[model samples]
Target: EPEVTQTPSHQVTQMGQEVILRCVPISNHLYFYWYRQILGQKVEFLVSFYNNEISEKSEIFDDQFSVERPDGSNFTLKIRSTKLEDSAMYFCASGRDSNTEAFFGQGTRLTVV
Candidate 1:
């Protein structure tokens, strides 16, 4: 079975530093999304991308956050400046369409100091 893969399963960064979380979603899926879970909190939607453009985004995806599909196979989330509150498990998800069940990656755990 196909699955999403994220690099550097765990990352530790200093506050105010930049971090780039990377993911390779399922190839055949047409829609991709980025979500984050802050510790025990519920999973929160960040942004969604399709056809090489941002389809939608949540308020949490502020100026500090950006998503990009630099190539056909990879999707990435960049946090320009890290904060202690930004520490969380960032998940990459993909689905064939908006109505379908999304497949999620194992997630990248980001820890800010």
Candidate 2:
């Protein structure tokens, strides 16, 4: 079974620094999304991408955050300036369609100091 894979399972960065979290979603999936979970909080949707453009985004996905497909196989989330509140587990998920089951990656834990 194909699955999403994220690099650098954990990352430590200083506040105000930039971080790029990478993910390779399932090959056949058409919709991709980025979500973040603050320590003990619920998973929050950041943004969704389809057909090489942003389909939707939440308020948490402010100007500091950006998503890109970049190529045929990889999806990425870039945080231009990290803040203490940016520390969380970022998950990459994909599905064949919005209504189908989405598969998630192990997630990249980002720590902002």
TM-scores, all candidates, are 0.98, 0.98
Give candidate 2's error at residue 64 in angstroms. 0.1
By how many angstroms RMSD does model 1 differ from the true structure?
0.6
Each candidate: what lDDT?
0.96, 0.96
lDDT of 1: 0.96
Model 1 backbone overlap count:
0
For model 2, which pairs clash? none
Q: Per-candidate RMSD vs. true structure? A: 0.6, 0.6
